[model samples]
Target: MVAISSPGIGSGLDINGLIGALMAAERLPLGVMNARKDELNTDLSAYGRLKGAISDFKSAMGSLGAIDKFSVNAASSSNDGVFTVGASSTAAPGSYSIDFSDNGTNQLAQAHRLTSLDFADTSSSIAATGTLRIDLGGNSFDVVIDASNDSLDGIKNAINSATDNTGVTATVITVDSGSRLLLSSDKTGAANSVTLSDVSGNVAATLGMTTVSAAQDAIFLLDGHQVTSASNTVTGAIEGVTIELNALGATGTTETLTVSRDIGAVQENVQAFVNAFNDLQGMIGYLSKGDLQGDNTLISIQSEMRNIFNTAPTGLGTSLQFLSEVGIKTTRTGELELDTSVLNEKLAEDFNGVAELFAHDDQGYAFRLEALADRQLAIDGIIDTREDGINARIDRIDAQIENFEYRLTLTEARYRAQFTALDGLLSSMQSTSNFLAQQLGSLPGSAAG
Candidate 1:
C-alpha cells in the first residue's frame, strides 16, 4: 500500500474538518475583543453628536447675552419712495422731518458720442495708441494702450482693470452713430470730478472724453436744517441713523422719519433661544434612550443642564431673575416653551429690566449657559475626556485582538499536527490487525484440506 500523504486518508476520518471546528472554538477571544471595539466606537460617536448639539445651544445663547439684541431699533419713513431709513442700537428714539431737493446724482464722465467712427466689432483695433491719464478726486492713474490692447473692447477692459482706477468704471455702448466708450465715476462729490487727458498719441481726444454730469452733493433738510452729503447714502446726518436717499419728494414736502425700539426682534430672538434649547434637549433625550442608555456621562450632562433651568439666576437684583419671568418655562418632557403674549407684555412694561435680566454680565441666564457650554466643550472638557477614554480602550482592544489571533493561529497548527499523527497511528494499528488475521486463516486451511 502507498503511504497516505493527506491527513485522514488511511483512517477515512474527517481530520481537517475536525481541526477547523476546534480552531473556531479557539478564536472565541477574538469575538469578545470585536464586541468590545464596537461598543467603544459607538460611545465615541455618541459623544460627538452630544458635543455638536451643545455647541449649537451655546451659539444661540450668545445672541441673548448681548444688550444690543434687546436694543434693536426700527426706523421708518412716512414716504418710503423718497428715502429709506435704518436705525441701529445707538439710535435714540425720535422722529425727524426730512425733505429732499432732488435725487442725488453720481459724477459721470462720458466719451463724446463718436458719429464718424464705427468700431462695433469688439476685436477692431483702435487708431490711437498711448497712455491715457485719468484723474478722479485728485487721484491720478494711467491706462496703457498698445497694439496688444488697442481694440475698443480692449481699451474698455484696460481702464476697468487699472490698479489705481479708484471708483472709475468704463463701458462701451452702441449708439445710432457708432460705438461710444463711457467712463463713469462712482464718487459723487464735487471734489471727485472725473477728468481725462491724453498724455501721448491723443488717446483721450480720439475717444472724445468729456464730462457729462458734474460731480454734485446730495442736499436734504433734516429737521429744517440743511444737510449735505457727497453720496446718496448719508451717514452721520443723525447719530446711529443711515439715510438712503432714493428719489426726490415733492417740493417743500417733508416726510416723517420715525425711529423706535424694535420689540418684535427682541421677541424673535427669545423664541430662537427657546427653540435651540428644546432641540438640544430632544437630542439628549434621544441619545440617552439608545446605545448610550444608562450612561453616567450623558446622565450627568442632562442633570447639569436641567439644573440651570430649575435654578434662578444669581446676582441679578431684579424682578426678572428667572427665565419664567420672561415667559420661558420648562415642560415635563424637558423642553422649553415660550409664551409670546406674556413676553411681549413684560417687554412693554419694563424693557430695560428684561434686557438686564438676560444680558447681565455675571448673573444672566444666557451668560451662565454660555459659560457652562464653553467649559464642557473645551479641549480638556467632559466630552473630549470621555472620547479620549473610549479611543484608548479601542486601541487596547485592537492590540489584544492581534495577540489573540496570533495565539489562535499557533493553536490551530498544533492541533492539526496532533490529529495528523493520530490518523497515521490508527492506520498502522489496523494494518497490523489485518496481517495477524490473515496468518491465522492460513494455518486453519490445513484442516480444510
Candidate 2:
C-alpha cells in the first residue's frame, strides 16, 4: 500500500504553513535571479532602440555620401510653353539661347499619318486576296487582305494584330458617308516615318490612302549653331542636357535656357542629414535615461560620429575640406546645425570644391561614417558582439535559475518529510500520555469528574 499520511491530521500541527515558510527562505535567491533577468531584458530592449538609430544614421550617411547629391543642376527655360529643359550630371553650368529654325521652317517634328478613303461599311468585303508590306522605323510586317477578312474593320484589325507590326497602329474612323481606315506611325520624327507598299496585292493602291501629315525632324538653333534631332525630345545637343521642344517656334523669337548648379538642392540634402543626426541625438538621449545610462558602446558610437564631422578630410587636394566650411556646426547641446546661407555661398563660389568636402571617395566625412556604421552593424561587429555577450550572460542566468529551481524542489520535499516525521512522533507521544491518564482516572477519580 502507498503510505498516504497527512502530517497535521493526528497531531493538529500546521505542517503546510510551516513548510511554506521554510521554502520561502529557500527561494530567496530565485527572487534576485528573476530581477536580474528583467534588467538584462531591459538592456536588450535599449540596445534594440540604439541599433535602429544607428541604422537610420547609416542610411543618412549613404545619402550624404552620394556624389550626385553635390552635382545637382537645375535647368530653366524662359518660355516653358515653348520648350522645357533637363540637365544631367555631365551638363556644365551654362546658358544657351534656343530658336526654332528647322531651315527657317519654324515647325516641330511630326508623325506620319496615312488615311484611306471611306468604305460602304465595316464588315463588307473591301479587297480580294492580297497582301501589303507595312514599314515603320526599323520594323516591318505584312498584312494579308483576303475574303476571310476584307472589310474596313477587318483590314484595321489585320494590320494592328500583325505579328511583327513594329511601330505602326491601324484604326478605323467614322466619316460622313462610312467608316475609313487610318494608319499612323506609333513614334514621332522623320526617321520613324511609316511606309506602305503593295506586296502580292493591290491593297495599298485600292484603298486610295492619302497622306494626312508628313514626317519631319526638329531643328533648333542653339546660340546660332544649328542642332537637329529626329525627335522633339532633343538630346546630345549640349552635354548632358535634353531639350524637349513643346511647340513650333518662329525664326525671329527665341528662348533662353539656363543651366546652373543647384545650391538649394545641396542645402536641402545637408539640412536633411542634420535633422536626422539631431533626431538620433535625441533618441540616444531618451534611451540613455533608462537601462542604457552611461553605456560605453553608445558613447563610442556618438563619439565616432562627432569625430567624423569635426575633423577635416585629408588628401582631397582642395581648400574646402571641412564640414564647417560649408556651415554645418555642432551646437552646445550636441545637435548638428546647418547654415544654408553659408552653404549656398560656398556652393555658388566653387560647387565641385564644396562637393569634395562631403562626397570624396576616401576621406569624406560621409564615407568614413558609412564605413564606421558598416563595421558597427556587420556580423560580429560592435553591436553584434555586445548583443551576443548579453545573450550569453542571460543564458547563464537562465541555467542558474533552472538549476536553482530544481534544488528548491528537492529542499521543499525534504522539509515536508522531516516535519511529517516530527508530527508523527509528537502524535504518538500524546497518545501514550492519554492512555496513561485514562487508566489513572478510571482507578481513582473516574466518578468525581
* Alpha-carbon TM-score of each model against the true structure: 0.84, 0.77
lDDT of 1 by residue, 360-432 (tens): 7766777778888898899989888888888888988988888888888888889989998889998998899
Task: Give the candidate number with the greatest lDDT.
Answer: 2
Clashes of each: 0, 0
What lDDT does candidate 1 reach at residue 344? Answer: 92
lDDT tens per residue, model 2, 1-449: 89996768878999999999989988999999999999999988888887888788778877778567676889999988889999997888998998863345556878889998878877788765588888887678898888888788888899888878797888888878887889888788888878778888788877888889998788778898877678889888999899999985554788899999877777777887788778888988987776888888888888887787778888885798778888988899988899888988887787777777777887888778778878988989888899999999999999999999999999999998898898999899999999998898889556774
State the TM-score for model 1.
Answer: 0.84
Candidate 2: which pairs clash? none
Q: Which candidate's TM-score is highest?
A: 1
Off by over 4 Å in 2: 1-45, 101-103, 387-449
Location of the lowest summed lDDT over 10 successive residues in candidate 1: 107-116
RMSD of each: 4.1, 5.3
